[model samples]
Target: MAISKPAVPPRIPCQQCPLRPRPSFRDFTEDELDFVASFKVAETPAEPGMAIMVEGERNPSLYTVLSGWGFRYKILEDGRRQILNYVLPGDMIGLQGNVMKEMQHSVEALTRMTLCTFERERFPQLFRSQPTLAFDITWIAAREESMLDEHLLSVGRRSAYERAAYLLAFLDARAQAAVASHTELRQLPLTQQHVADTLGLSLVHTNKTLRKLMDQGLVRWLDRGCEIIDAAGLYRAAEWRPPKEGARPFI
Candidate 1:
């Protein structure tokens, strides 16, 4: 399916960005903030189930998640789909598309989302004029790569129970970092089908495994989402430790 474009773009000032000034996010210099403000061209809102970007498309813009959730996935020739990663608020999207010729995977919004759009062609200018911002961009890319590597390990070696625990814990940590909130429960806007596709399990198996986690008090299933209940327990169950992260830049 073709991706949908925003009907109307919203104008958001960089100085007033919600992600800025949070303990988990880095503060930009006056000049750097002004540059990013100019760099941003538009803000687009996507509804649930809409494709923000499609596989193999040469899109002209890069995006940063301003709010809400999305997932990246690739479809095989046989029409089997594998989810690669989840995109949360404060995460950058389409960096690969900007650096390469086309997008390697598709990103679909799991909830109502707002994305900040930047011109791809001007990224080089940011690198040339603002070395710090450039470094932050590279840092974001490396962080994404590290997450993918961990996910690979989880899928390849971990048992279904361990994998489910690790995935939930990972998502909870990311949500906490993005929002800088220590709330006991965070909404995960995903279905059992998404969980199944991500973990390479059948829907029935996914449901059964999730029930086990629910019984253990690690997570609670909701009508349209899941709530992370015991993050520490999940970490222990998965034998995983979250990496320490410094302030992250949004753009």
Candidate 2:
């Protein structure tokens, strides 16, 4: 008799999953929640590296990152690629589609992903009908712009050590915001390839820099995630400073 392989598990719906427990629903009023529910659909499952939207394509949907990391990238005619950004849970990925209709870059899943997709027609309607959501999206876009500006600094001026240090500090801050503790660091889902693409550094150099961080007693990369051992030391190496103005708030 031939041996049979085990069946692959079916993907879990976002509602059923424990990871994304509707963090934003309470932020909406009952009427607002109803309106959003009418426009939003159940989660769309995506495989790792699946391209959700391609450059120059006529995009008709805007997505919320229900649970996963995604890469936004643009390609040059000569085939060189630059990763524009990474979007995490609760982040909006395709808001540009709402206005531009034609996407300037492609969005790909960095892991097995679930996205809450909304029709372009209904998405903009929410902005007009729901002023709160409009401001929320506006703030989100502005935050993305600020992050892009920081990336420009990292690529243009920061050395490899500074680049790696900056990323560590930034990741630590993100985890603190969500979990409310600077001592606790979130698991970094990024691989060396992802870091290299995002930071405009070669993969070999990125790996070397990460190892140097470990040697310097700034961070320890365990099996699950990186532990930030010395937060102040890391920030000092990166020349990081808090914004003079407050960071743009996003829901």
lDDT (Cα, 0-100) at 74 in candidate 1: 97
Model 2: colliding residue pairs: none
Candidate 1, 37-123: lDDT as tens digits:
999998999999999999999999989998899999999999899999999988999999876798999999999999998988999
- Residue 226: error of model 1 in Å? 0.7
lDDT of 2 by residue, 179-239 (tens): 3433354456667777777778888998899999989888877753467788888888777
Worst 10 residues of 1 by lDDT: 179-188
Compared with the true structure, the alpha-carbon lDDT of candidate 2 equals 0.71
Clashes of each: 0, 0
Cα-based lDDT for every prediction? 0.88, 0.71
- For residue 213, give model 1's deviation from the true position in Å: 0.6
Error of 2 at 70 (Å): 1.6
Query: lDDT (0-100) at residue 191 of candidate 2?
Result: 72
